[model samples]
Target: GLGDHPTVLYLGKLSRLEGSELLKGIIEEVLESVPNAMFLIVGDGPARESVERFVEQQGLSERVVFTGWVPHSRVADYIIAADICLLPRRHTSFSPYTSPENILKAGEYMALGKPVVAPKMGGFADAEFPVIPAEPEEMAQAVVEFLRNPRQVPEFQRPTWEVSHARLQRVYSAIGAVSR
Candidate 1:
């Protein structure tokens, strides 16, 4: 069962854009701090096979579990199973305007009161989401801190994922990105 280990979950695309390639270093660092840490990596993309090969090479087969891909309806189960959630992707230059609001899984994780460690780029920059926005290299420390002292995340209301009509008018009038 997952009860015996500190489970860290990464639920999203496994592409380089998503920082999936950096998972190897993050995993190795996390294990150094918390030897019994278990990683539950979900989703699949171009980098999945390469990431899997690294895991096997390091003989972390028992410590890490990859679920390939699961249906959207089942994401909550994985989020609930984790001790901590991670937004492994650090840079989002390709999509500079990507909004964190589009990350449906983030709302799910925070709604379940999971402490998410996301990078301060893309949509996550300056956003008021209830997550820990730490650099990707510093992620291991953030994960270890939470595992050592679990805390209830502040109440997070799931956003309606809608653009308010009033807000749109404000942006049009200002001719700039809106902030509120």
Candidate 2:
């Protein structure tokens, strides 16, 4: 049982680009403000072992819950259980132009009425939702602030797949018109 502990969730692959290192730092900072905070990492990848080691090294084993690999069907359960969703991708050379495929994950979290704390990079920078910085201190502050007033988090109206498909069609139509 999660009990009354405030849970911060990350529901994507545990890779280096996912900012596992920064997450550790943010966890330490968040603990200062939220002593009983729990981080629910709900995916597994090549970087899982290293992240686990880092958690242990930082003496954060008890606070961070690593769920390894969960079935896709069960992802929503974890999201529903979270108080906040985290997207801590660190900015890099590829971040400026490359949009992560996982941008949809932010929409999912928002659809569930969960506030997301993501770095302002790549797709996040262009996102309609609110975003914090990728810096550890800023992430920690955002998390603490959200916890203090969860209701203040902005409302996000997630577009349906059909709406997205129609928008793509419109874009293609305009591109064809220009290329003629």
RMSD of each: 5.6, 4.8
Q: Native-vs-model 2 lDDT?
A: 0.75
Q: What is the lDDT of residue 24 in candidate 2?
A: 73
lDDT string for model 1 (95-145, tens) is 554446436667678777677887766666666536777777887787888
TM-score of each model, paired residue for residue: 0.78, 0.77
User: What are the per-model numbers of colliding residue pairs?
Assistant: 0, 0
Please list the C-alpha lDDT of all candidates, in the order they appear: 0.77, 0.75
* Local error of candidate 1 at residue 177 (angstroms): 24
lDDT of 2 at 164: 70
Q: Model 1: residues >4 Å from true position, as ranges?
A: 97-102, 126-129, 155-180
Give the per-residue lDDT of model 2 (tens digit) for 1-180. 167888888888888777777777777777668888888989998888988888888888998899999998998899888988888776688665324555677777777767788776665655544444445448878888877666534432445676677677888888895342
